[model samples]
Target: MLYRLDISNILFLDIETVPEKEAFNALSEEKQLLWEQKTKYARKDEFTPAEFYERAGIWAEFGKIVCISVGYLTYTGENRNFRVTTFYGEEDKLLKEFKQLLETHFNQPKHLLCGHNAKEFDFPYIARRMVIHGIQLPYKLDLFGKKPWEIPHLDTMELWKFGDYKHYTSLKLMANVLGIPSPKDDMEGSMVRQVYYEEGDIDRIITYCELDVVTTAQVFLRLRGDALLPHDAIKKV
Candidate 1:
């Protein structure tokens, strides 16, 4: 059962992304046409490609990761602590560092990657961005030959679904219902592009991303019927 799994073996993470370019006109003509075609149906006639560009961070092909925040638990005797750290700045550099982290420390078969809605978004986005940058995929992110049961990944949203594929849950909503602290008190995902591009607030985005990791970890703990982590026990490493 999930409750029986070791907390220290799971790496909980979240990522913040923004469009590759600050403005739609900044893209090359070829890419502009491609983006138009790619988002044609989604934008319909209601909004032009430029108008829809703000939401481009949802797609890895058009977006770039700005921050990746990860959290993990460690236990010493009966005491436990949750530590978090963030990788930011140049996309390629942060991605390589994150890869090194997985390959070096969390590469064991028993290690699992967990996040809220990560299976559908964060996990694949990182893998796709890594491939676009020509970086070799770590075993945890590379899922080519792994069977369904063999994939060492977990999603709290999927767990909440309880085999109901039709349901969708946001991390904030999940935390609200579970009595976990809200991660969106300061800002929401939709504002990330504005914060990063216009405001030049990388630190704010990193804080938001790290809060998400902590909230996801808390959601997992609540799911496993464990005690909520005290605020003092969470350290930023």
Candidate 2:
């Protein structure tokens, strides 16, 4: 039997996360050094959480959200049409728009939620912030207390990992290994986080997130059916 998800009824979502603390970003290099020394996730060779905040745009603009691009895709007339609705933009309007989409467009407690690392990263990040903004949590995410397999979670990362403890397998690698197109090859994740901060360009960040979402949705389709043809994933801006 197929997973309880209908291909036509899911929203492919992804978010660009940023830190919420000002000191996380405004610290001077020397002070950043001191902060990093005390920070738990930072190391000399790795982008510590502090390092992530300082160098990456993960927490740009007082750590406010930069953008969230939600794409609607489904098998229609033997073709897939992907429409990315603006849940987020350079302004905070997208958040309210996104909330409306989740509440209105999606059938609560029924529509499946698809993402790459959404179960672990994207979903929680979005939901937590939504609650912070006083919006209701989407029903699919309300499956916190249910059994793992009980909830409708089509996490591409978890599906591929199959019980692996690696830091993270790049979405590009997963796409190639699964015979899906790695459109994410254009803008790397490190750059997604970096470009958002240095250039303050929300467009690049949105494009990056959208590319990853396309790759992720492609992965999901492949996982559902082996015969699904790869879409026209040519290099596009």
For each candidate, give its TM-score against the true structure. Answer: 0.98, 0.75
Q: lDDT tens digits, residues 1-237, model 1? A: 988899899999999999999999999999989999999999999999999999999999999999999999999898899999999999999999999999999999999999999999999999999999999999999999999999989999999999898999998889899998664458889999999999999998999899999999999999999999999899999
What would the per-residue lDDT of candidate 2 be over residues 132-208, giving only the tens digit for each residue?
A: 67666666666668887678667788777778868577677878888875563456665654566556776777778
Candidate number achieving the greatest TM-score relative to the actual structure: 1
lDDT of each: 0.95, 0.64
What is the model-wide C-alpha lDDT for candidate 1?
0.95
lDDT of 1 at 202: 94
Q: What's the TM for model 2?
A: 0.75
RMSD of each: 0.9, 4.5
